[model samples]
Target: MKVVTTEIPATSAPPTLGVLLAGGLARRMGGGDKPMRSIGGRTILERVIARLSPQCSGLILNANGDPARFAAFGLQVVADDVPGFPGPLAGILAALDWTATNRPEIEWVLSAAGDCPFLPRDLVARLHEARARENAQLAVAASGDQSHPVIGLWRVDLREELRHALVVEDLRKIDRWTARYPLATVMWPTEPLDPFFNANTVEDIAEAERLAALDDAS
Candidate 1:
């Protein structure tokens, strides 16, 4: 339960599985998968995958309800084991399950929300470094005043613990479940930019466009 700090450079490489949580109904955007929504002339999911793919050994989508919709993306799609669309935790569960059963060589599964197009380019590298430095089972990303639990690293061995939390404890909050085990959080400085900022709604999408423009300008 004690939190510590560590620094990870952008260049470090690590073995990881990148999993994007795209199962949300996106009621805020009128009931479609939010990742499929477009911004900056590309689907948000595409931008996310482009950013994460470089840092991970493999990638998959943790989605439910319908798998066929994401067929063109050409990534393994997994559903929640415990039904009723719990939250991102289910996605993490599916990622862990996939890594444990199919891709046993992967040591960690890096999770991020599908709508977060500005995800840190070094996300997996930093989280893995922090996890090693803290000797923790998981590591989360934080920026300035907020903690982004969805952006994290999950050890392959934590699958059983997560299954218990979802089925028996009924705990849905990601941080709450992470609290039961050792965790390390790496704070991303907000000076240059806030990497965890996400496009959650129409307004956020506009803001992302402005930010993207600024990024291109500079």
Candidate 2:
């Protein structure tokens, strides 16, 4: 892959939409919406919304359900267009298609895991900067040595290609599909707490509580 590095002007970032990926089965968390779990006396989804709302033109929830359960959040809820629970890629595609049809002016969409309550405040800006610096077609967040593929910025124009990859080609892994494009990675420090730390089980929730206490202290 060719990597072109350039400085992204402050005004160059495109109008972007935020998509919270909450389509997981959460089997390890006892089979409920993990985003709905409470931490620091608030639903994880609420923290996610609070963190992402200011970074995008608008926000939507990409989940598979009645949408009523999430009605309290008051954001538009979208479900995967491809059936059979294809995974995060499918949710990303759903957000892309939704943005294409409903918000044509939006050229970029940021996807973040709903279960991650402490997503970095500068997530969108940094992703945009990295993509601009690398002239990359896609950007994903990384910390330590691990890349969080689901937390990414995608061009709205690639919706059809992604749809084909998911529906026709049966591609499910986020990293596998991302490898075909010019990918820019933006790394965040993992001290104090990993911004992308997600709750996956009962114990994880307890850990989140401890982290929440730390977050409050800071």
lDDT of 2 by residue, 1-218 (tens): 11111223223467788899999999997798999999998889988887887777888889997898887788889999999999999999999999999999889999999999999988988999999989999999999899999999999999999999998999999999999999999999998999999999999999999999987677
- Give Cα distance to truth, residue 211, candidate 1, Å: 1.4
Clashing pairs in 2: none
- 96 in model 1: Cα distance from truth in Å? 0.6
Q: CA lDDT, every prediction?
A: 0.81, 0.90
Question: Model 2, residue 145: what's the lDDT?
Answer: 92
Best by TM-score: 2
Model 2 residue 218 CA deviation (Å) reads: 2.2
Q: What overall lDDT, based on C-alpha atoms, would model 2 receive against the true structure? A: 0.90
